[model samples]
Target: MDNKAIATDVLAAVGGKENVTYVTHCVTRLRFNLKDSGLADRDVIEKIPGVIGVQEAGGQYQVIIGTNVGQVYDEVCRVGGFAHETAVMPDKDSVGKKSILSSMLGTIIGCIMPLIPILIGTGLGKCILMIIQLAGIASSDTSMAFYVFSFVFDAGFTFLPVFTAIAAAKHFGSNQLMAALMGCALLHPNWTSLVSAADPKFIGDMFGIPLYGMSYASSLIPAILIVWVMSKLEGFLNAKLPELVRGMLTPLITLLIMTPLSFLLLAPAMGYLAVALGDALLTIYNAGGGVVIALICFVYPWMVVTGTHSTLAIAGMQLMAQTGYDPFSRTLPLVANMSQGAAALACALRTKNKKFRSTCLSTAFTVFFAGVSEPVIYGVTLRLKRPMWAVMIGSAAGGLVAGIFALKAYTWMTPSVINVAMWIGGDGLNNLFVAIAAMVVSAIVSFIATLLIGFEDPTSDEVEEGADYQL
Candidate 1:
């Protein structure tokens, strides 16, 4: 796609390098913290070759560039003279101006989006291993393959804090090695011993203050908090200490101060919030049933648009761990993805513009196969507007059917046609049947809905795909 030319064009469209404050990329988008967001022209940027779309959310100017975004990102850095991964944090003066909601959304996406590949990989591995058991090819309890895979998913979850801490440290501009050490300290054998005790509270005293403990493996918030505090502490030490001793003492003092404080204060005080979030989702699902399921699926695309859906993806794991099967999080995303694909497929059929039609067709295939919805979302549905509503409506229809049939996902893979094996759950082929039916329903509904609610078809032969701000 001529990345060099695209990068050169992108720099000019976004007001050149002088307006760029920070820059990074996720799996599919080039993220930018702009000196003034208004200075960037979204429409102009989307027309750049190799650009899929653009989104300004979570306080960042995001240029959607598909799977090869990393290549484009490096080119962008070179063309703009912006350093790679050098403190992507927004200016401190403007940080406080963000609403609490935007701040949380920003933090979650920044820290967790980088971990999506690990989560998806582990989930699919487990799903494949489970299939071997169901096929009677392996004894889940005794087979060598089972033994190898049994802990594969758990290993990802168990050391999630370490992974998450590294991501958080990078985002918050802290030393990643120190963050990794802090994560390990949280899961230290000594701490494990204390947590395994019958009564964890007041079992040990630190300066006459009672120490309470819990297993930090598979936990999320504590690692993020510790790393953030460490960043601040390390920064202070860097400024105050002499250059010779700074490196030696910075990490040492940061770890010593943050580690115990994390266990005694952060984990003890706030770690349960993650558990509570899982419980709250469960409670809400139980109360609302199929309607709640429908709602989650319906809103999930919007969540993806803002990159907030990453949290729910992980939350699904929490649900599965607690119940041994997840009915809520994992099930409907598949439905929604197919629904998006359906809407885009309809657009491909309905559009007279051949280029836009091709764009629509490719995006539909991406969602149906690769399970990525961003191309269709930014490149098609949201641009067309009516089709987006069709996607949500279709998802609601499918989600209702799925929830009514108690369709549960046994694994954590991104919901898509290719990953249907993920539906083999406690209910066996019944859930699998339900998943198939749900996908069919979502697609048919969205396709029909899109055709019915026709959009303003692009008239230009040179129809570059996308929309940034509205239906």
Candidate 2:
């Protein structure tokens, strides 16, 4: 069926348009924030053509759409009259029912998911520049091409607060412009200059209250916190203040109140928390190194299943931002992604059933190239059972090597074969070598393990369209 048809059917199965409070998509799923999840028939939704599966997590009824999620999401917006590229005010009742963890995941995913394209592009651009400079095409790292790419890529990190604030506002159902203003407020030139000063510790006082100083450029947590406050404060002022002054005064008052509050409290608190987190990760790495990474990789696929890996991914990015080095976040996930694909490749090569082989081949490609493993996880490994074990073993084995080298990544890179270059020059030539070796070990181990474990190959009658992953 076509995207529109699939979207239309799935929307109806999920209690129609009225049941949906808000909708968004990540790389492979249509994440629906519903007024009542029970209103939707998961079975019916799963049976719909083009839907790969259904999952309820993080306060969302997620329809797995594989590679074509974007097109289907657009169709969903068009058919449901939902605004394109904007989040609606979420259902209050549904929001209240979410666990604290779920809400946090939703907010983080909402905020960070939008920025992924920029991060990926920046990493890839840097990778290409490295290739060019290495080939002697750009003379040296100080060449004009290097400077151009530096600025182009640097803009994302430098202005991250502004971007994050806008995204947080959208997630919080606040004013985007107001959120943007808050982001800008964090990175204001005056603040940047003060932060760059020699002492750079304190900004004297406001109303005799000691004002502490901290830089907000390339920040994440601070922007999210400030914008969240902006949403609440904006809402309160909008409700209580007289209508005549509501629009003009609310924004003015929100900025006036939140800006100083951020510097004096929120930003500093967030900065400390960020530092503690990075330090804690570093300490853990120091203690176990490769063993820690192996354990993480072994458990990561389950985290992906439960949709909890997002927390780690976000933490990884924060670690990189805070310390300019991430020991596991960028590296282990890369090994795990390759392991899943490799495991599925084993299944593909082992299976004689034409349809099962095709299924394995396609999901392996999707996970390896597209950087999404939901398909491989559900479509191949879980179905075969043994391949799931192979995935864990393979990724964990690769993770051991990663730990021994203590690979350090400097970007918000995702897990994928294409992104191996993002891991390059992380520490030096040795880091690149470690990345390649880890990936190779992951694939070989997963492939060999799957073959050795020997999962029961699906028979001709057992396989059907969506049979492998669509449960």
Candidate 3:
């Protein structure tokens, strides 16, 4: 019933080392791409000691493991092998494009995933800074002590392009280092100073090509394009070149053809696309902000269920950076996360089974305090149909309220209760408080709703021993 035994069972169920095509873990699940989907014994895997559940969505067989998922994933990879073992699966063509709906959801979750650890770490770091400064234990200007906490907290966002490139590359099937290098090129020192100056001439020429003065630091688009291009180039070279020459030839060709193109054409075009997309989102906001929020609220839970929320996070950040506020789309998901968390907590308390009880408790606490909702999505709401209604009711109420306030968020901050401060100082504080209040009200209201409308009995397997259910 321990993690090791559970991991062993999972390895065996998913066709063992040979069957695994590729493997990775998000906040809550061990997502795998298998050579033969039929090889996986979902029921058997679901009944494993540590696993919370098993489901196939997004073209991947996902093993739910609650909070310590990363640890289990690591073990799976170790016993499995990079290609023959846990890490062996290559990126398959089937993992290609999903519907626009799926893509949008995927982007939102992707955007938030990298940002979560950084946001929580930084927010708490800032909290520490506040405590120390308030208590005369530290000073922003004079204390070397301030720098330590400040750097740890602030470094992630500051170097977000690098972080984004890593995640995006994994998503898009490119060399992570090459993608990171491309991100580095986008964030090159010279580019930063040029963009900051806002000089028309800053958009200079690169070997007869016009340089696009876009900042890549915390920005999106350019790095994604660069990485996408990298994937194509890698694939092209791998396919055409002979195996003997591929070792040296692929990287050379990819870097030569792809890198220059990334700097000259890809980055700039994507920058333009990003700007256009942000503008488009704002246009929608200006026209029907209320309706947009209501819809997002309604479907956001489904997005969460399907691992598609990352798109929104990226789009929201891009929108916020381009225009002061991102129409009505920015804060709806925040409410959704809070609502789901609250509902899950209620379910945790309502359920008699130990597995549901543990999952609900851990997921609810983290989602409430830290604003990470994967636990609730994987462990509770998705399992019990009624709890989802609680999330929906809360999301609809919260989204409508958000739309009415027309709240504006300036920074690309995470949707945590702690992030309320970052949203306060920028632009005017018009509906910032209202947005926060709506999120809180929605959470509480939805939590109570779940209690009133209870769910079916937990499955016998869902009530297993030593589940270690924390999200």
lDDT of 1 by residue, 1-471 (tens): 677887888878887887776677777788776767777898888767677777777766788778677788889888887755445555665566666876666666677767778878987888778778888888657687688777877688778889988988888888888888888887888878878874755557876778877667777777877778888888899999999999788778887788678877887665667668778987887788888889888887787787666667667766765566778877767888999999988988888878787788888888898887887887788877778899999999999999887788877677888888888867458889999999999999999999999999976643632422111
Tens digit per residue, CA lDDT, model 3, 1-471 = 366676778989998867766677766778776767788998788767677677666556778776677777667766775521112325455354346654444433443354556645665566556556656776868887787767776666667677777766776666778777777777777778778887623577777877666666666667765776677778788999999999898888888887668767877777778888888888877787767787788888887666556556667777755664555544866788789888987887777777667778877777776666766776678767888888988888788777777766544555677666545534445556777877887888788888888888687575554344453
- The candidate with the higher lDDT, 2 or 3, is 2
Question: For candidate 2, lDDT tens digit of each residue in 34-61?
Answer: 8888899988887787877788777677
TM-score of each: 0.89, 0.94, 0.78
lDDT to native, each model = 0.78, 0.81, 0.70
What value of lDDT does candidate 3 attain over all alpha carbons?
0.70
| TM value for model 1 | 0.89
TM-score of decoy 2: 0.94
Clashes of each: 0, 2, 23
- Candidate that beats the other on lDDT, 1 or 3, i.e. the better one: 1
Candidate 3 worst ten-residue window by lDDT = 82-91
